[model samples]
Target: MTIAIAPIDPVGRAFFAGVVSGIDLRKPPTAAEVAAVHDGMDEFGVLVFHDQDIDDEQQLAFSRALGPLETATGDIAAPHERRVSMDLNDISNLDKNNKVVARDDRRRLFGLGNQLWHSDSSFKPVPAKYSILSARTIPPTGGNTEFADMRAAYDALDEATRREVHDLVCVHSQIFSRGILGFTDFTEEERAKWAPVRQRLVRRHPRTGRLSLYLSSHAGGIEGWPVPEARAFLRDLTEHATQRRFVYAHVWRPHDLVMWDNRVTMHRARRYDHTAVRDMRRTTLTNEVSSLDQAP
Candidate 1:
């Protein structure tokens, strides 16, 4: 089957996202289709596919066709308590029994970090390259996912600010982001497991060779800077980067599959009723090289 891609943006602005059609993700994609998807990803940081209707195995198969998948780790759920396979991240409010998680549940509180803008797996030594999320079920209202185009954000920055951030490296940790919401109830082992990793503040995308500001809520501090100063700087950059013009808010529909390049965008989950179920499954592609290793 042939694949078609159309810009998601309205008539005049620079398009950072696209809607893809004519390829079924439930079955294994052909090599040519996979290459087309890669080309689409390089051109558009986010790609939306409607009516995917794929299960975990199909999702994994399709994601593997694009690149190596990153195993689910560092989740608040204990290994035995997880409802989904290790290969997929269970992005939902449901518990193992398929019931809505308690409002005060530690797992739920820990997940609140997702509401903050971040590039998936930024806390890892080798961060994520892309994230493919499928909407199995969606809430009747709210729970929209917002994505910010970091490449555009970087381009919009003043020359002086760009020069200042060019060589900066920031330390990222899950502990730091969750702490912002006062959810620091981690065990010593958990703390050790989620230890901070350093990444370049600006990255040059390997495929397009375009530069993007690599900012994340997971980033706690910039290397060699005082805590307050680093945090203030990061907060300022985040505020500037997430201005309405730079973002796209995606209102999900059941069976929708959205794939985004984590290297060039930051995304956050929107607020929704905790009592209503919103089931999303994500398969992330691993970045073999760290942002720190890549030339800025």
Candidate 2:
């Protein structure tokens, strides 16, 4: 099948939303096809490939074509071999037995962090560039993922607000975000592994030269600013940027592979029944090694 990319109208507005079809994700894409995929991602920021039923091996093969993959942090009870996959992260709510977790399970509570709008691994020193999530199992309703185009959001800001953030530096931490939801009891080891990192409030896409507001729920505070003022500013910016006009909400189907550029987008999971099952596996590409170095 010839691969093709088509735009999607998100409730009458499309902001970097596209649907990719006709490619067999089980096989590695040709050079031309890979170039086309990059072009779509660079322009759309979010691309959905429907009905691609690829396993972990095939998914890793295609993900490697984009860049070096991020390994799992071994923060869960999965075995050593699973953690060492080096290109996969299990984002599921299922246990080893493939059963839904009890509502009180610690893992489920920790996973609640996904409900907050954030860029993948924004607290990391190198940070994530792009992330791909494949839907294996989903509930009958809800659990949709929504993305906000920070590039457009930045453009929508008033001149004074834009100027204020252009040169500011903000600190990001996984601890801060989780704490906000009363999940404040991270083990000392976890805390040690994820100390805060500072990043610019505004980012420039190295290839497109477009500016995007680099906001995330992980943001702790602005450097050298009063803590309360910093929090207020960050909250205001988040509310302003995530308004309906800048968002694209994706409704999932079986065998769907959804990819988003983490640099220019923020995404979060919508609510669903805790008794039902939702299984998603993800592979992330980091700026430490990116496709942009070789993009056409």
**How does residue 112 of candidate 1 score in lDDT?**
90
Candidates in order, TM-scores: namely 0.98, 0.93
Q: Which parts of model 2 have CA positions greater than 4 angstroms off?
A: 74-86, 289-296
Candidate 1 residue-wise lDDT, 91-180, digit = tens: 999999999999999999999999999999999999999999999999999999999999999999999999999999999999999999
- In model 1, where is the ten-residue run with the lowest total lDDT? 7-16
Candidate 2, 107-145: lDDT as tens digits: 778778889999888888778888999998889999999
Which residue pairs come into collision in candidate 1? none
Question: Which numbered prediction scores highest in TM-score against the true structure?
Answer: 1
For residue 160, what is the lDDT in candidate 1?
A: 100
Which is the leading candidate under lDDT? 1
RMSD of 1: 0.8
Candidate 1's clash total is 0
